[model samples]
Target: MLNAFHFQQPLWLTALVPLGLLAWWLKRHRHNDNAWQKIIDAPLQALLLTEASGKSQPALLWLLASGWLIATLALANPSWEYQPRPVFQTDTAQVIVLDLSRSMDITDLKPTRLARAKFKVEDILAQQKEGLMGLVVFAGDAFTVTPLTRDNDTLRALLDSLSTQIMPAQGSRADLGLLKAAELFKQAGLHQGQVLLIADGAERKTSVQAAKVLQKQGYTVSVLGVGTPIGGPIPNVRDAQNQPIVVPLQVSTLQQIAKAGGGIYRPLQSDDQDIQDLLTSGKTIQGKQARQSDDLQHQDWKSEGPILVLLLLPLAALAFRRGWLLTLGFVIIPLLQPDPLMASPLDKLWLRPDQQADQALREGNYEQAEQLAQDPLRKGSAAYKRGQFEQAVNEFSQLHNPDAHYNRGNALARLGQYEAAIKAYDEALKQQPDMSDALTNKAKVQALLDQQKQQKNQDNKNKDNNENKKQDGKNQENSSSSENQQKNDQQSGQKNTEPSKNADGQSGEAPQDKNSAADNHTSSSPKDQDSRQAEQKKPASDEKSNNGKEQKKDNQFANANQAMDKNKGQEQPDENEDAIKAPPQSSQPAPENTEPRGDPKRQQAIQEADTLNNEEKLAAEQWLNRIPDDPGGLMRRKFKYQYQQRRQPAGISNQTPW
Candidate 1:
């Protein structure tokens, strides 16, 4: 409906109306012109009629004017003066899931599975319109190459970049691809869109799971199987001195993935024509007559109009004889020149300073070549030979030649500049991409970097731990010293107190009054504080001293007991008897003239009291008080009692005079 209404030039319509009116009027009133020449010579009139005439510039001018008018009308925002229509008949999105595994490298289907799939993708793009399209590639790992988009060109470019070699870890990851495709479909919000999976099913697990998930999400999948049932071995490609390295194709894993993904498994026919047929035959295909209601997109015709005019010049030259105007148009119009600067000369030319350096090195002028090689424009060969790795690095910085970079990397590696070497190699690869020597060298450098980094980290950790340990040891020592000092202070205070009594019925000497004791103890034992401090300072040493002191005391006690026994044995028998028979006396003399030895009873009491300890002395005093002074005359009774006792029995008393 939108195609019906269009803007037109009012001048053209008005001019055409007048011309039509004039033509009608002229046809009714005009008479044929008969010149006098016709009467003079009818033959001349016939000759004029027979002569061929060439086309005029005015007709071509009119044509050009009309074309310009039409173009102007188009630019005036022409639109249908009718109802709006939908651009898409259906709101379904479509996804093309391609298999990019190395197995796709198998040439069983003409070029390869990948090539066939790509052709089919182009066909699918050509067939379908509207909604969105997405590309998914699956190998060892599957990922969306491009999300569902309306742009077909971008999708096709994305497909072009895909290959089995992209993922080195080659295996058919059908399940993973399908699962990811399902996620994509979910993100795309394609409710009824189709999932077109193009893969030779190697692993069905992922594809099946994806299919189920998509079905649950209201998405349908159609599979285009890309490998034969009797699968071809996956080829392993390599470089054998510029020759193609062809390995056998592996089994097709995308087949089951396609089937499990709820897709129709259409075997990949190597022929482009065959693949085209299979893609278009499905119920999903939209025909050329499909009603597509798109907005009246106005293209910028101004640039195109001039270009069209330029294009018509050659045609004009061909059409007209002696077409000087067309020739002049071609000459006068300035043609766009190619941008020479856009392409770098360095791209085509290899200005290898290193190669030049190599020639210098071969000539035995190492130092000169090395110096020259250090120039930014020079190659790295001379620097490498001279063992000037850093200089080589500087030279190769500009060149970016692969072999030069590789040599520079070798030099840097010799100098232990692994990371810098990697950078050089990376640039070299940027210039000469996919150079295995550079790749292997880069990998080696990376590994070295990793090891060096790991070692450095370990060293740092160890250093930190050692520092912490030392700090902890110092802290522990300080804590122990403080504790010992506190213990020493406590011992000093305790030693100042009166000596503690033991169970041996002995009291220690009286502690001096506090003032005196403090002074005396300090003065008498200045070493006491020092000893305590020293003991605290060296507990183990002090412990040995305490043990020695206890041993010495034991020796002294044993010696004293032995001395007493020897003294007893040395005494004569009679002297021993006499000593036993004699009345006891106070060991110390009484205070001068205060008490005499003649007081036998008092003397005995005093002797007994003297033998008692302080506690026992009080009991002895009480016993003395209970005894009477004397019952009779002391001398008479004493003599008679002694004689009678001695005469009565020999063993009864010792009163017999000797």
Candidate 2:
């Protein structure tokens, strides 16, 4: 059947497009007079004959024009299907799970089972131009060594990098490997695929569960057994020393694992016939419905399209020398040249909206500059030197750049609108997951929030402490005033008036005389006096309670000191330490003009500075005599200072300049 693909030029086919004004003139002026009579009217018959020949040339030109027209259409690379029909097919994901266990080292097949398997997989992958392929290795445990992807180059590299040692542990668990492969597909959203298991049957029973999981996840398990039923002894080889060595491997178990995983097992044999049979065996499984499969025969219509054009191109070239050249040029050139307005440099070196925005920023006209930036990047760029996040965000928002979104997030964080900032940052991160600025800003905002929470807690604590202190002070003052009143009452109670004295230096009213009676009473009531003295000491005890409050303050100070010591031991700054540290400042010394010294000490110092934290760097710079303006001198200064700061042990007080 011949198919033309049903393509045709529109009503505007106006082939007259290339003929210009002369064609219009001919059409407007041509007259249909009697040709013989007109020829007779001509001055000479020879002249009339010449004119007829010239008319033939015009016919030839018309033929040439038609050729050019055809050439132009051919250049479009049209394809005509003999019987046009769409092919409907479903694709499958195929994963090759290889066993990288030490057992693969066995030389049952000339080189080894592992080597042969690798070779076979490489060949298969090379042939598989369509569909997805992946690699999994099982040794000790099963894991996906590579994900299913169309890029064979990356897959092959990952495959080549596989070795027995890569697994770390030693055991063949085909079930585990298959399960892993199935899980990989699940994660990658591959619903159906084939699992080609290539291994020496060493881990059948151990990995049965993993294999079952793979089967449940809707994967076809095709086990290619790579060892004999009558297995050979596992190899034992020594390095240089004459020492005993052994490595045991089981191949039989692998076949059983494959069978358990709902797959038919094929034995790996030395003969080529067995290999061929293995490659084509068991396409269908018993008691299970097969999925719609992609046909092995694929049509290369895309490739054939170009070929058709190529074939027509030469014919078009032949027509180029004919009158058809103008017509072809008229048709093809208009289509090939892209609209000039839409053209862009691949590297983006040319001035785009984003670049224009950047230029505006450089010129310091930030407001005007942001209008030039584009989206997903409307926020300008992440490369801000001085935290101009607001301007960056504005420009970036225009471009809709995610980095700009992240930059805006940072700016919001700095402004202390943390929750909103975090949301903005999350938006930024969603657009560009790997944005370090977004990550860093997220961490920073979280840290700030934590610090603010801590500070608020401290403030609340201090407030409570102050309230308690006030209450205690009030209690102390009340107790002191009450004691003074009690003392005054005791003094008033001590002063007493007596009526008369007794004749023997006592009052006459000895029984009635209270002074003589009181003297007798005092001797008998000494315990009462001791009780009074105890009452007097009560206020002093109260005063001692006040002293205890001082001890509590001292304890708080001790705890603070201990915390500092603890921080020093860890060699990492705590939040309080970080708060105390000065903010980053660019006081970097200018480069030195002097040549670098060969001195080891200077070199070590330079290295130290290079690695020093901000605090350490600052400290080191302080130790330098004078930072030089020259690059070399600056390097020496930076290094030596940083080294000294880093090398200093903890407990060395870092006193800041007042």
Candidate 3:
């Protein structure tokens, strides 16, 4: 062990041993200036101070240096080599014989007899250690699926894929399976090997004779019957009546075989005690081969590092009493110690501006953190967290990293600059082709922009609808006013025509009444003439009153017609004024003088979409189409799924507007 000893970290020895020598040199050259100055006169001070001897302990210094040297050697990680000593190992082999006959497919055992047998074999394989195992699968005949080998993986693979379909014929041939297993044992040149027979126990009487032959050849035959005594019918194999042919476990036949073979027989059950017992019995078989020994060289290094550390303990105890050395150690130890609060070892190694910024951020000094962050990525992150999106974008743009670009996109998106955000995300994807967060956020922002566009369009549509309604209302008012004016004009015309008709009637009646009055006056007596004159005076008074009233009516009619015409003219000017002031309705872009309507961001997106590739344009359109009408959330889900499939990079936080 001592001869084999070598240091694992010999480089550390070279580095640390020099430090011990430096400590020795400093101790040896040390001076006591104060003590010498006290003893010297002013004139002789220089000579006395130079020549004076100081209290020195070379032995103590040597001890301290020796302690350091030992500690350094300990750090060098000294160890020794290991040597291999030969020992006896048991040589045991087991051959598992699996029945693949149609009878094994019977389902009296939960799933099927064959399935249960396979499970039991798996359990045995799991428990088996330090042994070579072989597999023998049989139907009408037997064949070795795997030769005796220590490779359990190959064995399990062969066993797992085993089925009756692989067999050439269909029948229970336990005797043939046993013979095949025996052949494997013989090939391996083993005097004793255990044979585990897992089957549904539907075998010929001659199978017992085969077991007896295997027993004679030193094979321990253990039969594990894998079906119920009252078994179920084998699936898909029918009788003449087109009914399933039932097959039961031949427990007595399996027992007879085990008895003849000088081994125990057990029925396979839900509990795997039978397989466990079979494995245990196989372990009991001692190695029949002669024991062999060989000597091999190996590293068996014993650690002497801890022993060196123990040696320093006494040296440190002595050095603790020396005031100057103790003070020096106290100062040096603190300098060597790592910061306990720092999580990253690399951070502890270097005092970077980002680390300081991170600390400031943790302390809630966001502004100071941003100011201190020298790395553009870190500064952008700080600015973003503080809701200074524009500042974040500027800071992030300075860096060429994908994360920076992605973060800038986030910032731009927050500012509602969606087109620019999409461009930023595109840049991020170009930098790191697998930047998934950028893709997801890009899709989200694009969708939001589209939604805004749809909303803007809807708003414009609504505004147009309202304007149409207003115009209709104005038209209806104009039509109503014109009808009222026409009615007034007709009334005035009727008044003028009615006065002429009344005058014609008065002229025609006056001539006839005058002639009749002349004839009556000639035939009347003198007294009658006097009374007629009085009556005529009364009639004249009445006619004058009637004429005055007629004149008053005509004047009033003329005044009414003038007032109606004046009102009609006034209303016509108002209608003309309304028509002149009203804005023209058209399905066209706004004039250059007018401000562009709808969300500016949405318009910008639509404009930017013209510059995008087919895939991107399609994505943009899909996002835009996810309007309020998407009650099924189909568009939203599609966007999410596509983004997820893109597998965007992690690390960035997504806080999209939509």
Candidate 4:
């Protein structure tokens, strides 16, 4: 217990000088010329000293100093007791170390060895559902692609930008790559994980030693070879006599590295067998569940700072008349004031407006969060969370930023106003063209709009059919009623006529009425036929045009879905899948880049591929597959900075930049 005594913040002990430690310091540095204290007795000195006197006032000085020391100790927050805490962790942690040396430029495997490795990485990502994965790339030096995370999208996005040209230096350094993998585990506060090294081979001899060190640290290292044993020369390079430098796959070196690290090694394969084997080699700790149960009852150190502050009361009591009254008054007066009390809620005294709103949001108080939010963006987000999409749109409409437009589009979409949402997305794209979310959402909303229009057309067609049937029934009823009236009129005429009158006028009039009835029927028949023909022609033309438009838009939507499925499935990509094909109404370009390539006629580098993989093997076969002209721009800057950091220590060399 005595050995456990230590300051939580030892630097705060400096405050002891101004409090009680200054007793000796004040004596040596005293400026007062009070010679009477040398001759005067203790009682006489106490009687003669005033409140303003410094060195003469020993009791008051010592009391204030002791109290200050106690207060400072409380602030330091010393702890002695412990409280239990539960911790949960997973053993499925892996760090993939990739080799980005110049030799990876060999086109023996697909478009290049590096491209095949990227595809393998994607496969592993898709397989690992609940594991934390990290990425590190190395050539002359190693650089982290990302820390251990369960987010596969981030890994995929970063992986797309990697290339042989991304590395600052141009040589193999597999030893540094292994060391970097170990560093990733240390940073994640994990002792055990699998280190998967995807490389052709190691050029440095120290790679075996580095692997051994990593294995000793409880990490199981694995290697996946990514090249043909037949060997291929590095692209765009020649010897002094203009001879290409041919480099073969060094399978033995990779095997040695795996053996030293106590892991398994496999060559790259088309199937998922290699990844499954690497994943199975994970080092799982024994009794994990038992340890977790015991850990739930653990004890962490409980800080005793508040209790220690009690010692200051007695010491401060002596200085009440002189010291603590002023300090205490300064602290209490602000709270006693009425200004801050009227302005905001009690939480505002401690937390910022945004913080208070976030706390309320976390507590499921969306209305309060909306009220507390000052920024338009936050207010809109809170309203959206509360299911008030109209209010969210209103709040988002006040801002001009791209994110504001995007959020407004979402709100409009939730309100079932797809056209408005699409317009909002268009506005967002106008400000930031590279916004992928906007592009994806806009395409979806457009498809939805097309479907909605098609449904409306079908509904109108049904309504027209019902109305036409009703009109035909009414016309038939009127024609039958007219015929009955005509029949009744003829019967009344016969009853009014005299019997057996030989050449009566009623007979001649009856014949004339019959002929008039026949003429009316003939004229109405032709008019009805012409009217029916015109209506049928108009609807037939409308239906045909609607079907054509629907088919065209539907095909565009299907193609976009197919492109996304290929991306997610990591399968062969079509030659036409250069860009996500959107409908004619969309503003996005069909091709990713308009900039010319080596073959100006063929803007893509897809022609330069290997024999093993099919033409549609990669959705992004080349670096220029996306909007960014240089896909590796971000990695180039990162490795450049890291390489410079390594060179900062002037006394040591970076082992000939390898």
| Residue-wise C-alpha lDDT for candidate 4, range 1-658, written one tens digit per residue | 5566666777776776665447777677564447776777868877986546554466656666667777888877786556667665544688999998777888899889999999999999898776678999987678888989989889998887898767765557788888888898999887778899999977546788889999999888899999999879875444333445677788999999999999999999999999888877763432352244343355667777889888877665655756666787799999998864455566468999899998888988999999899999999999999899999999999999999999999999999999999999999989997687887788778778987986576445444444455666666676676667666765676687654332643446566566657754553456664765566566556555655565455568668857646654533232123222211221121222345556754633455443326534553343223332555775777777777566422111333221
Q: lDDT for every model?
A: 0.55, 0.56, 0.68, 0.73
Error of 4 at 522 (Å): 99
Per-candidate total of colliding backbone pairs = 27, 44, 12, 8
- List, residue by residue over 1-658, the lDDT tens digit for candidate 1: 5455554333433434444565576556432233444464676775655323323544554444444444444344344443444344534466776776555777777777678778888877876655577877665455566777778888766655565544422345565666666777678654455677776654444446667777667655666666565656443222212223333322334444444444455555645654454444433443322334243344331222233345455545654655655666787675654545574656424656666565566787887666656455444666556677777666766555567777777778888988878887877878886576777777767778887975564344334334445655665675467556655665687686766574776665453245444554354244655755454446434334444453354456446636644665753343333323422110111111346669899979878767879767655554444343322233223333443343211111221010
Count backbone overlaps in model 1.
Answer: 27
Q: Give per-model CA RMSD.
A: 43.0, 27.6, 37.3, 28.3
User: Candidate 2, which segments miss by more than 4 Å at Cα?
Assistant: 1-54, 77-89, 190-192, 227-251, 269-658
Work out the TM-score per prediction: 0.33, 0.36, 0.41, 0.37
Ranking by lDDT: 4, 3, 2, 1
Model 3 agreement with the true structure over 215-252: per-residue lDDT tens digits? 99888888898887788876544443334567778889
Task: Name the runs in model 4 displaced over 4 angstroms.
Answer: 1-89, 283-631, 648-658
Candidate 3 is scored at a TM of 0.41
TM-score of model 1 relative to the true fold?
A: 0.33
lDDT of 3 at 56: 52
Error of 3 at 119 (Å): 2.1
How big is the positional error of residue 241 in model 4, measured in Å on the Cα after superposition?
2.2
